[model samples]
Target: MSEANTALSDERIKNTSRLRTALIRPELGGICGTIIVFALFLIFAGDSGMFNSQGVMNWSIVSAQFMIIAVGACMLMIAGEFDLSVGSMIGFAGMMIAIFTVTLEWPVWQAILVTFALCIAIGALSGYIVVRTGLPSFIVTLAFLFILRGFTIYLPQLIERRTIIGGIDDAAEGDWLAGLFGGKIFGGLFQWLGDNGIIATFERGTRAGDPVVDGIPMLIVWAIGLVIVGHFILVRTRFGNWIFAAGGDAQAARYTGVPVNRVKILMFMFTAFCATVFATCQVMEFGSAGADRGLLKEFEAIIAVVIGGALLTGGYGSVIGAALGALIFGVVQQGLFFAGVESSLFRVFLGLILLFAVILNTYIRRLITGER
Candidate 1:
């Protein structure tokens, strides 16, 4: 009887240990939070068809837009930095693309290539300044934020006397490079579904044969591709290790032979590259750019990263978690409309979620690290 009791006790101890380990995973908090938000929205918004094909596509598309920058922001945060200028960078890039292609009549591809190169240079410059000055990134990026935002507004007005730039769609017409970046894929599958009644079609309209659900948007494809690549780099590559080490302890990382400064500079450039990609996608989809485009996006990207279980101080995070965080934002942002809540109230919801997520994440980190 004593032997049997002892065996049962040992099994219980092993089970408890396994449960604790699972609970302490960095992404577990994000996963649970996403599920809860999804469930709540589903219960309240089911009749609004948020789970339907069209609704799914709508939210997923918006989420992809957020995820691209959020992934970059997550990586940067992991390496102990911030870029408040990302939102302005988007606006600037969009405007540059428009001016290059429309006002100057440069080829769309050339304009795009030039814009990307310039963006990288800007990022590298910012990183260099931060490293050389030993200044906090918040202050440095804040300055760039205003500078870039001012340029985005002033440059267009000075040249064209207006804040909006158009004609991109016309320039992209028949351009294979533009099509590659902005074009949709899997037309046959959607067409077949629409034809065979597997997917819904427009009812009683001139476009009656068109499928309500077309091919997946390019933005979503890019988001997923980047997320996978980011996850791989973070989890399975040497650079990822360098990123964590740099953020965790810059001095120690340098002492240990890591190129901390180079890693950070590259991360900064990568973040800028992501912002440009987002700008490219939006400009392509809408066929225009505006000075006010991408406003406040920097905060949203950071919020997504924080909600993804990445610490603000750096050194701990997961790209998959950031993706999930974007998903939660998408669900809430769209779900609120479906649930008939006022759009203005969404900020309140975000504030509350961010607060709670920070608290939960902090507690979980402590548990995992065995800190009081």
Candidate 2:
């Protein structure tokens, strides 16, 4: 009888272990949502060009850009903060870079360095204000959002006498720094494939008759690399534990010597840095800057992080989930176009998805905590 009881106990333990493993994965919600969304889109738009190489490239590029910002936003949310100024920061950074290079006639590399330094300073200031004043980050960053946006518009008009800042292409022409940030890689593989007739050539192929692979865009590379690094930092480091503790309970974490204030402030800085990276990539790709760039991107980043299963109250989230959420956004945005849906209706879709994700995340949390 004792031997039989032991065997039953072992079986129950094994089952519980599997259940706990499944429950602990914060990205599970994102993975499931991604699969469902992808399947739905595939079903409705399979006959269209949605699955084609060019179509995939289009959506993936947008998704990569969203993920670039969303990753940092997720980290900040996990640290119990928000940055409404991220979108404005993108515009501000791009404008700064363009003004530095084109108006001031500075080298591209020098302009880049100066722009990055200013971005860090702005981030530190924002963080410092929040930490020192004990004000909510939401309030502090909201103020910055307006300040940066106004400056982004007013600065160019003040100096260049116009809202649009152009001439970046001319300034960056033949510059190696521009090439490093804007150029593509893997041209040889695609060229070889095109030559070998392994891939279909466009009706109007290049003079070299190569396929239009266009290689891999630099933005996509940055998104993937940043996501990997962010994931590692969140899951494999002691600082990650501090972040969770800080967000979970600031008082308790501080009592335990977690340096909660420092962690939160650093998170704010990281958020700004990510915004700057996004701005840099866009400026390099378009070779221009304007005050209107990156509008409403802050909401989009927050939505992605929320859909990735991060709690609004803080402390539970996954970087991988945020990346998948970005992927979902990209798919839906591109799929709507392929399906002949009106682009203006995209906001409605986002609202619905955000609502559903919040509800789903809450339910998952209850299950994990065994809450009634």
Candidate 3:
């Protein structure tokens, strides 16, 4: 072939290969699933106010909750570890905040700070044990799951004679740090929209001409912020490469000068930090902390990470993919309620989707490894 023709042919071949690779990407499933879920919800729940501003906020908040925990779980999984203690950490952290602020009458900001420090320390301890003993992270964190849950229940009962702590709202009144987790943003913009008839407002009450959604909740903001930061750390920096290397092959990574132990331990601490963030938000929103709060949330976060296309083996994933998976969860959960379907079926959906995701991941892993 002539030089010009050969060059053109090569370009065409490259474009074709690129398309094929994109089609098989780990995020492909999450992207497709998100589209289908949204389409389905729009069709079935379109007229039910589920697409309205208020409805959008509902699902968005739920999705953000999932996104927050999933970010931490995603990074940890990418580093080849699991932290089953995440749910317990949430309850424990919230309880600690409540105990410090309410029972002990500490300032809300001080309580929040102390709770975060303690939770992160516990997470570091969990990581240290796993690294020193060479035990599976699953087992170590599972033990912590029970240990922390026990403390969550026992401490509240011992201190307040109950497993539920309240009065947080009163204590947090005018508290600056509490506002960061509990406050809303963009109030003026939402107010403008409401005045312009762009969004629904309270017709007649003590509060009239006010938007149903005053502003975006801080929970969603935290979720977006975490995703952005996590994505940057995972893809744009040297540490990001180290995470993949450590997960992909710890011994090889160590020989190559990757700080595998430190990376894994930091990931564990990060997971705990995320859990505390969730707990703080929840406590501020609800004005209470219960021992049973965050039950099974660890599994939900794992499912979100898995559905986002992170392999069970580790070293391959996308933060954006995980966020999409969380969005899918948030939509389907509220969509079912809006469509008037039984809410219990959400668990069934979780089971099915998890199975499908695992099968799909296995196929993708085999494809990458050329395994039979």
Candidate 4:
């Protein structure tokens, strides 16, 4: 073959191989387990309305939100680092927005802007401490978590000016924000779901074309937008190449001119910003915020990331896949309610998923490294 033809053939081969990796089913264990989840929910719980179109509609966006955070966590994990304080940070962000608005009587716009700044700063600060001190991110974030948790406890008393901040006099003010984040999609037939739709939405009670939604949950949109950005960064940009290189082999990447430290710091900061985005959504939706808002969400994000197939040691996984992992988690949680199983059983299932995902991640890492 001529030179051009040979080059074209080589490119085709590489594209085909990568596509196979991206599109193939995950390990037999995970694919089978996921299949079982779908089957069991369908078989045993179908009668309970979980199988209906409206029920499935109810779960999709929330699942998408979880997937978003899982994408960020997956990025961090791929870079061979971790942070455990995101949950508390979300609570902090929610409380911060509420305190600025409900307590200080700040305008909604001002409060939102300030809260956004705080979250980004906090995330960067955490990243800085982790990098500068050489302490493990796990330990550092744990310390941060405790500190933030304590602050959340104090927030209500301060905001309420009496050990509680309630009687907001309006959830409407924040509705715009909520709808932007956690709004509903089609309820019944239009959605290609199982049945007709009717839900006495907690927010509007009854409204045609409204989806009768609640909350200014911009977090959901924020998460999706971030995922798109992340996808671009991961797959379509030079930064993505460095990310893979840094995570896959930091020392080598550095020797080859990657700015290793800067990328790590950026990753850490980005994760923190995600926590903030979620927190903002919660405050808009709940119309109230407390220090306890994000008590365990960070841990859940980590679990979602791992389950999505990101390797703990770095240099493996996809943003979309990790997001899917989060969906799996949210589905199971919602599924439990439909199944009427105890809440504790859901946690048990989460643990099992984590265990299996970790084992598989390790195996995938082995496969990739052997080739390297």
TM-score of each: 0.94, 0.93, 0.95, 0.81
Which should have the higher TM-score, number 1 or number 4? Answer: 1
Off by over 4 Å in 2: 1-21, 205-208
Q: For model 4, how does the per-residue alpha-carbon lDDT over 164-251 read when each residue is reduced to its tens digit?
A: 3443326435545445544433334342221224433333445444443332234555667787888789889888888888788889
Cα lDDT tens digits for candidate 2, 1-372:
788776655544435576666866789878988999899989999889778767777899999999999998999999998999999999999999999998999999889878988987898899899988999999999999999999999999999999888888788888877776677888788778777876545667355576757578888988998899999999999999988888888889988899988899899889988998899889998989999998999999999999998988888899999999999998999899998999989889999999999998888788777798
TM-score of 2: 0.93
Estimate, for each residue in 210-256, the C-alpha lDDT of model 1 and write its tens digit. 99988987888899999999999998999999999989889999999
Write the number of the candidate with greater lDDT, choosing between 1 and 4. 1
How many clashes in each candidate?
0, 0, 0, 7
| After superposition, candidate 3 runs with Cα above 4 Å error | 1-19
Model 2 RMSD, rounded to 1 decimal: 3.2
- TM-score ranking from best candidate downward: 3, 1, 2, 4
Q: Against the unseen true structure, what C-alpha lDDT does each candidate score?
A: 0.90, 0.89, 0.93, 0.70
Error at 265, model 3, angstroms: 0.1
After superposing candidate 4, which stretches have Cα over 4 Å from the reference? 1-35, 159-164, 167-179, 182-220
Candidate 2: deviation at residue 175, Å?
A: 2.7
Worst 10 residues of 1 by lDDT: 7-16
